[model samples]
Target chain A: MIVAKRKPFDEIMEMLEEYKKVLVVGCGTCVAVCLVGGEKEANILATELEMARKLADNPIEVDSVTLERQCDREYLAELDDKQTDYDALISMACGVGIQFLAERFPDKPVFPAVDTAGLAVNQAVGWYEERCRSCQQCVLAWTGGICPVTMCAKGLYNGPCGGTNLGNCEIDPDQPCAWYLIHERLAKQGRLHHIKQIYEAVGWRDTMPRTLIQPGYKKPEKEEAK
Target chain B: MSTDNGLKSGSNLEKILKAGHFAFTGELGPPRGTGAKEVIEKAQHLKGNVDSVNITDNQTAVVRMASWAASLLLVQEGLEPNFQMVCRDRNRLAMQADILGVYTHGVKNMLCLSGDHAKFGDHPDAKGVFDIDSMQLIAMVKQMRDEGKFLGGAEIEHPPKIFIGAASNPFAVPHEWRVHRLAKKIEAGVDFIQTQCIYNMERFRQFIKEANDMGLTEKCFILAGVTPMKSVGMAKYMKNKVPGMDVPDEIIERLQGAGKGKVAEEGIKIACEQIEEFKEMKGVAGVHLMAIEWEHKVPEIAERAGVLPRPTVE
Candidate 1:
């Protein structure tokens, strides 16, 4: 659930203008869920590119394909056979998928059509709001399910700030203060008293992140020795 | 005093609306199978009978023939194609980009909707991305037109004059909420509304009356949607499986009573009856024939309903 806002049309057109035959690829994963990267979107983009190009007398040829999961090696194999058809590729996947495609097809130029934002939860149907920062730690058990990282404009760890006005954030009058929501949530759970307990300062460092890392298996002695 | 006269000429949508009454419009669902030839053939069949043929992005959320390819084919064949743009699959950037692209290709009409979920269709594993609803997309388009700049502040030499159309499901779950949703679209400045498939004429007339009473009927052009139920199975599916659709028991029972060979004919007859009735109803601007898989029968349905007159030229 990556919360991403779409890029403007003119920017995309300028990118496509540089390529004559463009292969628009869509990823069927987080980007697809956010509606930025999907087969349908890729095709729509391809169509728009074709239309825009035709008007400019360039008449670009667009061939679109949607991979099941652009980040996976097996799913990315689908693009290997069709790589020769286009001069460049416009991927509708997230940063990861675009990188994977670039890694797989180093010979051809690959571009991203969507800018991947942070993880989001659907506030309602068709509305996605940023929720989590994936801080590599689970503190929700202590925070009572309210995320201060996303809710707070400053991502503050403790207490109200000068921006907190009458229980509402000064940044947005309509939004409830994150601290207020946290207080309410903790109060409902009868854990409001725990709010006073000083927790260790959080360190924001992610040296490496793996989406599908396996654990508990030791490699062969020869492989491990290397 | 002269500076106060900032009012301009009617928008492109106004030009299209003033172009004629009983303006015929039909939808083209991208094929699920490997047969775009069938889609092209059907578009050719609907060419003269309808004012514009709508190419759906992905109806029911199943992967299929691309709307842009199908629409490009239609335009190549010299037919006015209305491209159905959905926010279910793209964010605002992609949506705006695609709209501008289609406009450059001579696509005139656009029916915006928050498309169906993947769970409802064949691909259960598919992810549904609803970046923006129909209204937001409409506002984006209006912004592109009036301001001559995109949300990203990119300048445009000339913006497209696309007729902005939105969807309405008066028969949606919890009927009372439908009016509120329709009001949302109206407030968003949608030029026209094409409702979800209507089966009960009584229910449709009531919807029209209420809309007029709310002063919405006059603000936007209302096009009643009609889909011919193929058989008893389809009738049942439309009643139960189909989202945002209402199929009366009488129509279902009629289809159930009819045998295999006559079921399609009966369904077409009922749909035609609905259209004929819609033609006489006041405040009803036009009809959007969503023939679904049975798109070839659109000309027949239009002719049967007496809406066919070669779609009088403007």
Candidate 2:
């Protein structure tokens, strides 16, 4: 799932420096799952913003709404009041949600309140570890389930670099060397021979920012003269 | 143009190795900060005493003057440098560019190493980019030389003709697998390998014996590494702390028994003894003396070990 973290209090305040009244919109999908932007968080943030403004003697009103998803227009339609009473909107969703909301309400200033980190899996409560780089081309089958593109510090496709010490990366001891894990995994499956072949350098053309258009999915042009 | 000795246009070390001479290579670590004064001085101490000097690429992952720049400085000092390039800092883009850059500056011999992790060095916060493993790097350079092409097969106007080198660790765990790994690197087009420091002769002997059984000795030069222990503390640190390094208990005990100020001398003696025995070991080519920061000891140790007065290839 996509993982994101809330911006620090000071940075959020800086984004709201020029505004007095604000509407905080939260996403109920990824941001909610990652425990950053949800109905509860949106309410808490509203209270915190009120207190921050009160402490500064610059009193301001804040209201919030949790949309089913900030990315979907249907969910965004829930906030179609067209009431431009607020000075700005603080989106507590991923960058996609923030941009989509901005496009829907073109007149109001929309700002992101969180940084979209990466695709990750939850290791435990309050901890989300990055698992994939979304390189668009997956080599998991060949590597025995270990993702060197994201796990290895150098993103090497071949075997471990010489600096792999004690099965831990030389750069960070906490992280296991990706190739080491791959070797162990491959060895376990009796597919160790696959580790020997020299792999070709990865091409980033299709993966740089991957997008897809399925067959027969494109909108067809109007039929001209038969 | 080739030198008068009719060796390659690049490294004198390459010429020496090609001529079937026992090569004695030492390592020179570039200073952490700018200013080449310290590196140049160290090179001067090793000049003429060893065939070629390897300028480390941020040895132990601590940042230093760029290895290429240090290599160029050594070249200016009239010393052939076996430049060591690590994959930890740059991706394939910068790596390929630096290979060409080093070749243009007259570097002839190059070693590909997976650099030590950044956490072991001063900059623990920095991220590491292991874009390509050492094995792939060897193949990449070999391709650049043999086919005059990049990793993606784009032709270069002038290809870098470098003698490729890689590192080997016989002491690391899963010892039986190391020889095969060396074979893989050899298959990838490596010409020579410098093993991790040898304090465990028994393990190293087994490694070489297995390597010979696989007939890997004929394919590449095996330069056994020997770093003399400066103190028992260093020995303990290497044995317990350093990864892929093995300092046998006997050696550590021997260092502890060295008594007072004699540990350093005892360490040198042990290193000299290993060099002496390694010269007679079958399939062993020569000794790679890595006196690390103690660069001054290289000449004296080389002299005592009888690999002194490096061969003149021309």
Candidate 3:
């Protein structure tokens, strides 16, 4: 799931300083699962913003609403009935949802309240770790299901570099070396031959802004203009 | 030295090793800022004392003058540079472009490495571009040179003539697999190999013996890396702080035994001893003396190690 963290309170306050009234928006999907931008978080942020502004002698009005999923237009249509008196909209969703909300309400200024981290797995209630970079090309079959692109600090494509020490990364002793893990897993599975093959250089499909059209979703060319 | 048809790039280091001489090489790290004076001064120490000097590309991930540019500076100063290229900074296109560029400027040798992660360097926030690992980089260079083709299989009108080298770390984890890794590097078309700094002679000896058993030594020249520990503090730091560095407790104890005033001298003596031993070790072709930041001491170290008056080959 996509993971995000709330932006620093000071930065969020600074962005909303000019607005007299604001609406704090949240998503109910990935961000909610990660305990970052759920309805509870949005209400807490709204209360904190009201109290902080009242104390600064600049009292302002703030409201918050949590939608099912901000990325879908159908869920976003539920906001049409809400009063549109807000000077700015504060998005508490991931980057994609924030952009979608901005596009839906093009007139109101939209400020991001959370920084989208990456595609990750929830390790615990409050802890999460990145699992994939969505590099557009995956080599998991050869690497024993370990993603070197995300786990290794250098994102090495071949074997481990000289920095692998005692199965840990040179960057930090706590972080396990991705290649070392791959080697051990492959060795146990009797698939060591997979790593021996020289994997070619990554083509970097993610280098540009990527747009994927699924097989059935791509528009057909207009019948060749009969 | 008999002239053989097997000389790949005809680099000075390659020629010396191919001539059956116990070759000696040194390292010169480019400065963080743009200044040729430092590079020149450093090269002066290694001018006639070693076969060729390795110009590091942002060693430890710190920003520095490009290695190719520094290599050109060495070429201008009448010295051969083992131009180091790290996968941390460049994609294949940039790497191939620089290889061609450096060759035109008279640089001959190239060292492929997966550079230290950028998080450990000055620019911790910089994006690391490991589009290819060191193994892939070595294979790509071999393709460019031997096959006369780019990585994309396009014909190169004139490819860079490079003596390829890669780094080995026998002290890294899964010690049993180190020799296999060396064999893989040999298969990838590496002409020579320089290992990480060796303070744990026991493990390194075992690694060399395994390589010998696997017949990997016959395929490529193995240059053992040595760095003189400046002080006991540095020894402890390397043993504790630096990952993949196997500074055995015995070496640190030896450094401490040399009273505080004589630790540096003891460090030099230890390095010289390692070099002397490498000369007699089977399958060991050379010694890569890396006096980190203490380039001025290289000449003395090389002379004391009895590798002075480096050989010249046509």
Find the candidate with the highest TM-score and give its number: 3
Docking class of 3: medium
For lDDT, the strongest prediction is 3
User: What global local distance difference test value does model 3 have?
Assistant: 0.91
Off by over 4 Å in 3: A81-83, A219-226, B1-6
Per-residue lDDT of A92-126 in model 3, one digit per residue for the tens?
Answer: 99999999898888887999999999999878888
Relative to the true structure, how large is the alpha-carbon lDDT of every model?
Answer: 0.73, 0.85, 0.91
Best by DockQ: 3
What order do candidates take by TM-score, descending? 3, 2, 1
Off by over 4 Å in 2: A80-83, A205-208, A219-226, B1-10
Model 2, global lDDT: 0.85
User: How well is each residue in A75-151 modelled by candidate 2, as lDDT tens digits?
Assistant: 88887784277899999999889998898889999988899998889898879999898778898998998899889
Query: iRMS values in order, in angstroms?
Result: 19.1, 2.3, 1.1
Worst 10 residues of 3 chain A by lDDT: A217-226
Tens digits of lDDT, candidate 3, B1-314: 11246767778888899899998999999998888998999999999999999999999888899999999999999999999999989888999999999988888899999999999999999899888889989999999989889999999987777899999999988887788788888888899999999999999999999999989999999999999999999999989888889998999999999996999999999999999999999999999989999999998998899997898987
